[model samples]
Target: MAEVAISDAQERSAESPALAGLAAAEAPRAPAFIVTIYGDVVEPRGGMLWMGTLIDCCARHGLNESLVRTAVSRLVGAGRLEGVRIGRRSYYRLSEAARSEFREAARLLFAPPPVPEDWLLCLSEGLRDIDLPLPWARLAANIALAPNRDDLMPVDGILMRAKQLDGHGDLAVLAADRWSLPEVAGAYGDFLASHGGLRDLLARNVTLSPEVALALRLRLVHDYRHAALSDPRLPRAAYPQDWPAEEARNLFVCAYVGLSKAAEAHVGAEFLSPEGHLAPHNGETERRLFQLRREAAG
Candidate 1:
């Protein structure tokens, strides 16, 4: 039998005013159930859970019925939690990819960069100006490991053709198809993790509408993907010398600083540390990302 030991500290934190406010009214236990479910199935061969089974599991953990249902629904909607329907009952399980994504997200949320603030900024600035001769061939390898999207490619072609008609040029079809959305998302996730503190700073100080924030994040992510793809170096290639690797590094840092400010302005300062650590946002971001993922799955 597997067991999860919820420490007294966890109990107290769950009951804390900060956490309580984040969790919706009438669902104090939802957050706890979310953590429990994630922890339970994070490992391999942990066994699948059905709706009924989850209900039972919640009971064991003293979670309320309503809260469990809400959490499960939200998780399912987010993509972190998946469901298989047979006849009447729906079986729930975490997708393998989701597990890896969540782990990466958690690491980003918790891990702190060791570089000094000034040095980090200097390196980032230097990378931007010097373009390294990246090995573009590595893009093939990245494409192979990433998810495929034939539907998007057709749309891409249509857009390209339309641009040609309008006398505007676009990349060749092959090049356009070289990158996958999941890989892009994954890369952005990695980028966010690496410079989370900086992002926290931005999220806190920036005053932007929700729509603008989303646009900024998407644009930055897109720029990163294209930059990686255009490099002659392989998809996994490190920053090349052709560009100022330091400048590029600084760009990433600045981006995170902006994202941090946005998160703080929209979410709350409690989710970040004075130095822009994401410890406070770890649980919330995990839950939000999980929910977003569940929605994607459906």
Candidate 2:
């Protein structure tokens, strides 16, 4: 059994008034917060959850039950979720399409894919008509460039592996031209400014209440998700020396793991799935905590 050993320091930190306000920083929009709850908690235990559980969780973030219901209705209409009526209770699960999308988001958060070492040079006559994904930038009428990721392959062009050899231009300059480094950097900087203190608080071995822990964890991931998804995951050589993406990632891992124990306790005791209260320590939850701990150690 995986166990969270709380220190006496954490017990004391819980009594501090300043530390208690960490989770009360600010509330995100209802739709986004609901998505965060499903992605972080519901998706792991099972893809489905009770409506009451969702409302109760969102309430911690100052989202009213009516707003949550409306947001959930909108999510269902948008094909992000599906609902079923079980007697008087209603349960919602991620739609198949949304599940696939959430899985990709989860990869970027929990287990980031490696940056592509090779570059792809795609040459095609019909480049304008073709839709190229994965941050491909059109360099010419018949050519485009992108980091060759394993998950993406463009069949519309003659793809060739490329290596830069003694080029006059700096890689960082090329990166800025091809991608919005300033925007991405700004997002990371914002994330650090907002949640950076949580890292220090956790380092002091602070133990938050289950409600606060879960609320803060949701907020943490909700904010980090915006930044992580925006990032194109370019090779380290392509990034500026002052890039704070890695630092933000490390802080996320530390604070997330620090809060996992109390957060899971909240889920176990309060959050409900179609099958009654969620088990606090399922394989998926344990695996996530274990993987994050390993990431924190590294």
Candidate 3:
């Protein structure tokens, strides 16, 4: 058995207030859509936007304006957003607590994947009942492995280098026990199938209407972000054979880059600034993300 150790710091972080209401409120479809919108547009672009601009952005995705308004109201009630009104104009910003949550998300999504130091196979009592931030996989009773140690949780458990074991007997089975490789791979596969053909068509120099461009862009980001959150986002070694992650990523890049100009045109024309003018609301955050994507493609 490997030596067991506990991390006090990790325990405190698990109960951190920044992550409140994430999984709970996101169960409903409208809230989920609103969260996606926040990730794609609101969070990155100076973190504040008018209510009308938000409604118009959702409208491109075929969401009703009233429905979008309701979603925003619920999000504010849920403590994820702050709503402000000046005269007749209304605006919302990511609550400071919510900003911390999404900042970590943005870091994970954009940074290059890193290899972990070691895989800790831990056996501890009351693990299921205890709240730790480990990317947990339950082995028999009172057993789990920390696949992600990037942010180690405060827990007492045996530790060992991943290379020390040949993954014999139970270890071989435990990897599967920890994460459902097939399901994660299958999600990537489904994502690729849904968007692949359109990506290829765009690659062949097809044109899209401004509405279509913005709508498709939102849909693609919405789905991709959801997948990223659900996935363990392990290293390439953790993937099963025939994993479609790279393929899905390619389709995402192709479609988003191909649609950028038209989508920007639409937002620039349709979404106005706080000044109530038809000025383009381009910001550095948007440019940086697009630049990162373009660099990744090349």
Top lDDT prediction, candidate number: 2
TM-score per prediction, in order, is 0.28, 0.90, 0.76
The segments of candidate 1 whose C-alpha lies over 4 angstroms from its true place after superposition are 1-32, 105-119, 122-298
The candidate with the higher TM-score, 1 or 2, is: 2
How well does candidate 3 match the true structure, expressed as C-alpha RMSD? 15.5
CA shift at 10, candidate 1, in angstroms?
26
Residue 58 lDDT, candidate 2, scale 0-100: 86
lDDT of 2 by residue, 1-298 (tens): 1233455455555635433454456667988778888899989888889999899888777788999999999999999999999999999999999889888888888987887786888889989777667678888878998888876646587989987766666988888878888899998998888888786677777667787788778888998999988888777788999999989999899889888888889989998877888888789878888888988787
lDDT of 2 at 147: 81
How many residue pairs clash in each candidate at the backbone level?
62, 0, 5
Write the candidate numbers in order of decreasing TM-score.
2, 3, 1
After superposition, the stretches of candidate 3 with alpha carbons farther than 4 Å from their true spots are: 1-28, 115-118, 126-128, 131-134, 148-159, 164-173, 273-283, 290-298
- Candidate 3 per-residue C-alpha lDDT over 53-147 given as tens digits, one digit per residue, 9 for 90 to 100: 77776654556788888888899999998887887889788788888877766655555346564566677776767765547666656776665
Give the CA lDDT, 0 to 100, for residue 252 in model 2: 93
